[model samples]
Target: MKTDGAEVLSKTVTQDEAAILDAWNVALLEGTSLQSGRIREAELQTQVKTVFGQLRDALASGGLDADAAGFASLRETLADISRSRAIQGFTPTDTANFVFSLKEPIFDALKRMPDGDATALAAGVWAAGKVLDRLGLQTMEVFLASREEVIGRQGQEIAELSTPVVRLWDGILALPLIGTLDSARTGVVMENLLQAIVDEEAEIAIIDITGVPTVDTLVAQHLLKTVAAARLMGADCIVSGIRPQIAQTMVHLGVELNVVSKATLADAFAVALKRTGRKVVRQQASTEGRR
Candidate 1:
């Protein structure tokens, strides 16, 4: 029976599965030894065996195309492996090398096939290379996509963490703006402040922008929107941390924040306390001094 290159390569890999796996692992380690601590060799060995087993089965099934329906399971497995490696801090080269490294072991197996001429061996090697190349490219694609998702989620978490609502007093909530207020961050800020107000049943919410570097018309509009949202929630809003430059810019830009304004958070808090009919007085010295 005259078998094609794909059949010859797949049969050899399945027959010498253990040796091929060992060689593949060695090649992979050689390529990524610098990242030795990122993953364990044993775990990598298991994953290697799984992927190789799937590849061998698919090739033996007479479908050399990596994207064929027969290779769907293999592609899914590679995507999972790529995503895992990406989250484990593996570089793209390291991730794709997981598929590429198998090429050498399969090629070596092809060369050692019994009764096979040099031409046949080369053909088998070429076929295996094309398949592995396709699989490696698939891995890289999945790696990039997984990395993007991780970055997006991390950015969202940072935005949420940056916007925290604090209860300054019983009837006062403070949202200290620290970074640039874009539309997205403004929405998060408004949601957090409004939720805090309802939860605390607060009557005043102070938005302090001491950390804000500049105030443009857009920023003024965001502040107004937040103030409007808080007022709709039955709480008055105070805007504080108005530097001379920011005040000047707001006036020049014809941007009006139709809410109580203060130059400092302390002043805003004091105003809130007075509006809520609360007072903070210093304790006098004991009368023993007068005695």
Candidate 2:
């Protein structure tokens, strides 16, 4: 029977699995940060073994296409490795080297084939290169996707953290704005303020933008949206942080906040206090003070 290149290659790798795995490990350590202790020796060994074992099986089954049903398990394994490496802060090149590193060992094994299959060298090397390249590309794709997911989730977390709604009193809440207030931040601002309103049963929300450097038409529109959302939730809103420059800009832009506006967070808070039927009275000196 005439054994094909893939069959011959698979047989060679299976027969020299131990030696091939060692060579693969050496290649990975030399080319990657596996020694920096991101991944333990045992885990690294296991990963190499799993990938090689699957590769051998898939090649034997003529499953070279990465998307083929026969290679599904192998693709899943690669994806898992990619995601793990991505979370470990591995660079894209390092993550891909996990598969590409195996190329040296595999090709070395191919060259050592006995005279009987020596004629299979060219074909075997070509097939092996194509398959490994496909798998390496797959690993890179998954790594990038995992990194994107991590970034998007972290971005949302930071947005929420940046927009904190504090309870100033029993019926009043304050959302102190800082930095630029764009549409995206406005949405975050609105959600946080509304949720706090329900959570604190707040009747008034003071949006203190004293930290806001300037107010543009768009910024004003965003503020109006937030105020509208709060009003719909039965909570009145106060726009604070008005400066000489900002007040002038709003006037020229014909931007009407409609709700009460204050010059500072303290002014907004004081309004919040009185409207909530609360006050801050200073204690007078007693006989102890006189003594």
| TM-score for each candidate, following the candidate numbering | 0.89, 0.87
User: What is the alpha-carbon lDDT for the whole of candidate 2?
Assistant: 0.85
Local distance difference test, each candidate? 0.88, 0.85
Question: How large is the C-alpha RMSD of every model relative to the true structure?
Answer: 3.4, 3.4
Write the residue-wise lDDT of candidate 1 on 65-96 in tens digits.
88898899999999999998889899887887
Superpose all Cα atoms of candidate 2 onto the true structure and report the RMSD in Å to 1 decimal.
3.4
Worst lDDT 10-window in candidate 1: 282-291
Model 2, residue 233: C-alpha shift (Å): 3.4
lDDT of 1 at 281: 69
Clashing pairs in 1: none
Summarize candidate 2's per-residue lDDT along 159-257 as a digit string, tens digits: 778889988889888888877888888888888889889999999999888778888888888998999999999999998878889899889989877
Q: Rate residue 58 of model 2 by lDDT.
A: 81
